[model samples]
Target: MQEHSHLDVGDADPPPGTARPGGRTARNREAVLDAALGLLAEHGYAATCVQDIATRSGVAASTIYRRWGNRDGVILDLAGTLVAEPVGALPDTGDLERDLTLLGRVILDVMSNPRDGVVQSTLVAAGVHSPTARRTLAQIINRRVEDTKIIAERAVERGDVPADTDAGKVINTLAAPIYHRWYILGEEPTDDELAGFARVAAHAARDALLT
Candidate 1:
């Protein structure tokens, strides 16, 4: 496979070579990450190289290796930063159904994004071939699970869901279908489809656990 060139970071020049230490470091890191993400999206994992990332980021290959170790390290860092941003906090509209519908919409919006799709595809491929990749991906997802647990706990506290509701299952059900459709079947979930999943999932949880 031929290696692709790095992403152009546009004409916005980095600060002069002698600028403040903190700002320069931040800019370089962001540039590297942005370029890496772009390249990963464009070329997938196999064709991307450290030299490409450095060229795309306008940094030195030595600098990238020093900073991120290797290609896997760069991707791990990217996944960490990307997943760290919390999606909007779980909705609490006083109605469990309505709140879940909102959550479904948010999830649909996230999964349908092309950038997210690229990241998912790269990670999935990596997980199949690299133990480190699999573990890193697991960590990223575990954090998301923790976030969902908090939402589930809040729902129980508000009497929107039963205390014994399997929060993990509830959360997984909401996302699994969409993920399957997108990543497994290569089909994006429609808004109506997402709404239906949310409705059915919420109803099942209610009937089974909430009496």
Candidate 2:
């Protein structure tokens, strides 16, 4: 397992000699990022190397070096891409229970998917010690929390939750137990357990306890 560093997005650009090539260059860049993500999912950050990524991506080592500067650079870019992909996009079902249940299902699906789950775990492990990685993870999580806040806001509009509820905080609280189970206790929630969690969160929100 790769050692983790807490991350923060830094202001560093690709080093002095880098080129911003377009056209096929863009394609290569995408390929490289995909390759990096795949490797990170499989081998983790410490084990993943730039040369291996170049081989998997079919991009030249020189290109990766020129484009990203280093292995951490590639991983950071990969983290950005991974985190930007939306999760838990709930439908406007009008019923809060159904919507929240759907959201819980989505969360469970993503957290349990082999590829996504491994990639997430690997990234967090990398983030433990790396400030850049830590920042990247924080940014990704913040985006997710913001996205989840939409659900709370909608619930409020529908009179399913308190108007004064702090959406972000509520969402985070709702997710806390799930994350604790997975990350800390190394366990997955069963279907019933997942549903129960969602119910509790929804009721808590409805009762104005999530303020």
Candidate 3:
């Protein structure tokens, strides 16, 4: 998301007579990323390759290589885009339960989407072989945590939670069960279950009852 600004390198600034650097670079990125995502959705991770993406997107493999470094980089960027949430902009309904439920639903919606789910599953498969994929996934999770941390901070400021409350823990607790259901158990949770998850997590955080 906006959590990793460094990963979102836009087009370069214009120097002399050149048009916007982002014009072609940005177009190429969009095309390549779209192609990659479509392939991941249709054929899955292992079957998709740079050459296939290049052919589908009408871009060069060298360009994709130069821009993204490898397939892992491309998938990482795709994952980031799929799950991009604005930093520090979590829902504020003045009630911790509603806010946490909103956050949990957002997470579930993102992870359970068809394309996003395929991307995540592919990343997990890649992680078995590539240390870089594993690290990138961890960084993505950290970024998500950072983005959601503001919710807990606001709850603390509103006297809903302790100043020493662990934001990461709270967020992770809210997310873990949903993630387990989808990613580990390969089960799709109903809306009521998602709402219950949010309510429990918020209640736990509010009472400081969770260890």
Using TM-score as the measure, the top candidate is 2
Tens digit per residue, CA lDDT, model 1, 100-159:
677777666655455555565677788988887787777766667667666566667887
Candidate 2 residue lDDT tens string, 112-205: 6655565667667777878777788778778888877787898888877878988887677667778888888889877787677778887888
State model 3's lDDT: 0.75
Poorly placed runs, candidate 3 (over 4 Å): 1-9, 12-20, 23-26, 65-70, 80-89, 114-116, 209-211
Judge candidate 2 at residue 49 and give its lDDT. 93
Q: Report the lDDT tens digits of candidate 3 across residue range 59-155.
A: 9999889778777778887776644645435788988778888888777776756665667678777878888777766776778888887877788
Query: Each candidate's TM vs. the true structure?
Result: 0.77, 0.80, 0.78
Clashing pairs in 1: none
Q: Among these predicted structures, which one has the highest lDDT? A: 3
Q: What C-alpha lDDT does candidate 1 achieve relative to the native structure?
A: 0.71
| Candidate 3, RMSD to the unseen true structure | 5.4
What TM-score does structure 1 among the candidates reach? 0.77
The Cα local distance difference test for each model comes to: 0.71, 0.72, 0.75
Candidate that beats the other on lDDT, 1 or 3, i.e. the better one = 3
Lowest summed lDDT window (length 10), candidate 2: 1-10
Error of 2 at 80 (Å): 1.1
